[model samples]
Target chain A: MHDSAQDDVTTMTFEAFADTILPGEKRFPGDVTVAGVAVGGGAVASGAVAVLRTDEGGMAPALDNLAEALNGHAGGYAAERGLSLDPAVPPFVALSFADRTELVARLTAPTHPERDIWVSVAMFSTIAFDAAAHLHTVDALADGHPGMTTMGFKPPEADGLWRFPEFSYGRQLARPHPDTTPSGSPA
Target chain B: MTAIESTDVVVVGSGFGGAITAYHLAAGGARVVVLERGPWLTGQDFDQDFKFGSSSTRAFDFTIGDGMSVLAGNCVGGGSVVYFAAMPRAPRFVFERHGSIGRRMWPAAISRDTLEPWYDRVAEALPVTRQDWSDVPYAGGLWAAACHHAGRTANPVPVAIDNERCVNCNWMMSGCRFDAKRSLLLNYLPAAIAHGARIRPLHEAQRLERSDDGGYRLHYTVVDDVDYRVEVGGGAIDAKVVVLAAGAGATPVILQRSADTLGPMPAAVGRYFSGNGERLNTAVIDEDRVREVLGLSRSDGVPYEAYQIGKGPCVATWDRLDGSLPEYLRYSLEQLYFPPGFGTILAQVPDATGPTWFGAEKKELLRHWKSWLTIFTMSEDDNEGVFGPPPPTGNAVRVSQQMLGRGALRYRPTENTLRGWAASDAEVRDILERDGLARVMPWTNDVVGAYTVHPLASCRIGDDPATSALDDRHELRGHPGIFVTDGSAVPGALTVNPAMTIAALAERAVPAIVEAARQRGVAVRYGAPAPDGATAARDAVLPLVAGRAGR
Candidate 1:
């Protein structure tokens, strides 16, 4: 079945969550730990995670448990976060972007039982961020986003011709026949 | 009271095999109707983005024994629409690999001589050529240098792409956006449609029954929608001749599903499955060299072109120099270029390493996107595997098993043959190290996700029904009007891209099929003789596509 994780993340909270995890312009230059501008806007990041989970499986249910844990009703995930006894706040779906990010960070903290949730969602989000923020254009990369361009990458011109300098080696390999046979050929 | 649509011939699965068969048969003047499970995707529908082509429904991704997923395209043009477009002819050693068995099956069932002309016809219809050094992106240069340093030949690999029209956007994996890649959608399917062939895109074949009128009755479903799960409704058709070209993975399941009504198949029905011994090895070159060598240095405000463009053709291939091993057993290296954006997330890595290397390390890899080059080694498999009784993984299994037999569809790769793929990886690393062009990545023995793009064998052809599924003519032995003509009919791996050979074999098989329909009193109009099939060449088959006519 198609994982509906993407459908769940299309709201403002997921976008805020994405931005918190990978803020494009929020972080200062050379400070990896510094905060950056928010990343998620469209359904791309969540959708990518959903797609990955569809093939890889397991991520969907973990996401479900994390969501439930945040609502403070089911799973010890919230209890471990010391929120199990707290009056059930708004459903994870209703939480604000900052609230959602805080909830996700706590759930995915190294000490948290559901840290793997961060791994799947974060990896997919990071990849999605590259495609959406950096790959399409340099404007996307330099808008406080660290990508290939930030590293001063000089990407190749895919349209024009450039000499390979090893053409002769290739031609030698493409030469014609020897009427060869298999190892077990009956001579 | 026949509650089904009828046609002169019903070709299942519009892939390289089915599409080519439809073209030849329709050209031959037979009333042809094709049933494809995927949508009729045009070039415009293809997107350059990473997630654009990752349709769960359109691209059939299923796992078999050991929980490793094997992928195959499910669109109208089948695998040809989603492959690397690398079209190398089966070498003599490939056909002569299994001793007498290979000899009989190779030349007798579908001779290279019979196929060379069809290959030419296909080439003429599509754009097949090799790119010199000037033809590819900077990544191509790395491959050429590595081959040269290793003292191996790096021949140009022929791809069905028109260089003139190609922008080298390198999004061939998601389907070509510029329409430069000559998939069957452009060539064979269009020709078939022009010649009066009916293509039903979302109509998937479900079951087969022998009609009372001595024809074949096919039960199918019209797919309403295919997202994460396949949503389908029932349908049916009747035809005098039924050609099964679903795929090596699906065709056996289709036949096995209908086995009760069709009676027993040979013991080798799902046996002899090969993964073509495919393996992937990647390395990172000096990031500065990408800009310095390719002249793609940073300008003031130019957008960083993170996508792979102009790297369309596989660029180069390195063959095994030592003639000691069988040609089929020999390994060849090809290069792969992924858009940096997509590579950051989806590129191959050591097994279970992706999740752990998040945040910084992942960013570091993305930072040097232009420096990474993935080399693929496609070695011919020894043909020892099966496809059936897999744990229910996806809808293809659930639905097909509901119609056919339970536990009838699974793909089992040969452990030993797969182990043999390790050397090819090592060889690629050695070449890279020798060239000093790049630093080799850690080798991952993740054969579970072992890619089988060129899946062949399973329902193979031979002279005996006891040992083989089909006869020398590609007829399903006991079943007169039934034929299996896709990659499943190949007895062994071609040691190269099998699309051209598969299409060529379909071209050769159709004339005989037309003759059979004629004997059955089906009115089939024989079109002009195929460009190559008409004039059978007596010369020894050349090495690859470039040797066939010329670049």
Candidate 2:
């Protein structure tokens, strides 16, 4: 009955931990230009807000999805980028605006407090959210909070993989390349 | 207005030690009152994934060891409610060694037999069991693999967890989502309440004073929705006894504050604090090897690996605090990592002062990670103070922690220690690289002082009242009736977790306390009639998972 065998991330139905710990929040006006589409590797840019939804509350395991989306199902993304990240960790992606070109950074050394621990910044991105739902309530400070009163928890580094055409990308958050990939399924 | 009430025994601090103590006394017929600073967290209240506390308030903003930002649960359950829930006992020989260090009775005089039963009592209550390996045999592979590689498996630890309730919260540090970890929330505190112990959470104790005839006048505050503190003026509770189970850090502060009535300044108290000679060292297991030892479903999010070194199953030792790991064991791990799993092995050095402290400077800490097969080792230090670290330079002395890696005790090293860690840096580097983990500085293998899990000997017990804080039975000599049943009474270091010992001592002192009160002519009848044997209707207990699980 114990999922102790699974990674720390898999033990939950919807990932509420990373959501809370690293913490991410975003709010948009309901009237903002909204478009929803699937997300792929690369970056996800949307004026309206959007969210990722996996088929199940459990979602496809983080690594599997990361591998599919970040490197493309058959390792296409890595092949294209010619990057050398270990496959040991599933390909995970990060949620970012088009111009924030910096690839998120992560701590990989063991001496660090969380050396072997795995976290998929990219994968957590494509989950379900209600941009429309957010508009229903206001954080009063959205207009007055000093700094990032909200954030879509960009990955500190690429820890997992993504599922192509599997992402929900739109201004209301948009569906990115995944939906637009040549084949109906992200190719 | 002050709400005053009295009881046969008053327990302060809702940690495992105090909770257990209260539970025993209440069940034994004494009416008990328990005070905690945190709220009750039940399964339903567990829904907060990131904000740990149902309310986003942090555990404790108070400063503890060396300006470190401390966090102890303010919830009804206390420390156990927030700990990783490991219940190892002090080694049998730990208390038998006061003479070796030029001190008498380091293992304060107490019967092991009296505490033996409680150990089992506690284990059963938690329904604590070993982690099940069938489904994810390799998940918690790290510890097991390391043990085998180290040849330390014969004494693997027995965790106080209900495996059935465990889930992949992957955030044990934040707190367990599954109730499997028998933290105070699920065990002691509940049983105490069942035995008629009343716990008032969010009642932050700010000051304490002994009333003339005895008992206590506690000044506490109440926190409401608006985060406003409502002062409940000091009120006197004419109880016959009070047990201070507040943690090592806070316990000393209490004694230090009431130095006059509490008794003479003991050369102990907060002295010789060790984070269990606790260390964070890594054993190299490649990516694939990591999988072999610790089974991880890449998709699952984290390795379900359960790994640990040092004491367990029965006793804890200053076993860690240093990496004098035998050579053969090291070879065994290297041998185990036959096939490559992860590229390099990882060893995370957790600190009692991580982030949030030291300006929470992540930038500086990140730089220390370069080329190191990292791990932190906390060792037991014998030289402690009666009063605490000297002031003026207390700040500067705190920063000297960097010197711990090579700081040696004045005398001989413990039976299984490096005589001089300062000379082993090259050896460690060679040993690790030869074994395929990482290359690091020369003193990596030296004798670093242990950070300790807060073991203490303040108000330590002794025969002579003039020299120590408390006498043979944990009673402050001056007050005669006042007692310290928590870690505040230990006379020496414990090579294992002190909870079991603390509980045992506290339980042992009760009989004596009652006897004294009787001798003093106080009517000590066991409290109100017990309802049918079933535990009293539960207190506002909280579960690990919000609503998903039942208490």
Query: Which candidate comes out best when scored by lDDT?
Result: 1
Best by DockQ: 1
DockQ of each: 0.11, 0.02
Q: Write the per-residue lDDT of candidate 2 for residues B1-551, one digit (tens) a residue.
A: 64566667777777765776677567655777776655655554543222112221223222223211222444556555554454555544444444224555553445343344444444445544443233122312333333333333212234565645554332343335456566766766666788778987655554456765566655454544223232333344546676767665456555555555445545554444323332333333334443453333333443322221111121111222222433111111110110000111112222313311111121122122221223223233342423343222111111101100111111223433232232232333343344332333321111112223444565666665544567776676666566666665766545444555565565445555555555445455222111223222111111111231111
For A28-113, candidate 2 gives per-residue lDDT tens digits of: 34311111111211111210112122211122334333323333321443455565544443332222211011122222121333
Q: What does candidate 1's lDDT look like per residue over B1-551, in tens digits? A: 54688898999999978987788678767889999877777776765533323332244433323312345777788887777787766665555556224444553545554556656655555546655545555455556555655665565566777766666556576577667777888777887888899999877776688987898988877764433234466567889999999888777767766777878767777777776766666676654543444333323321222224344435445456233774444766777654433224434333333232333333444455555677766676666666654332222443221111123333444544554466676777787755244566532333223456677788887765655788877888778899888998887766566777777677556656776777767776444433333322212222222221121
**CA deviation > 4 Å runs, candidate 1:** A1-187, B52-67, B99-114, B225-232, B288-307, B321-323, B326-329, B339-363, B390-416, B442-448, B464-467, B525-551
State model 1's lDDT: 0.56
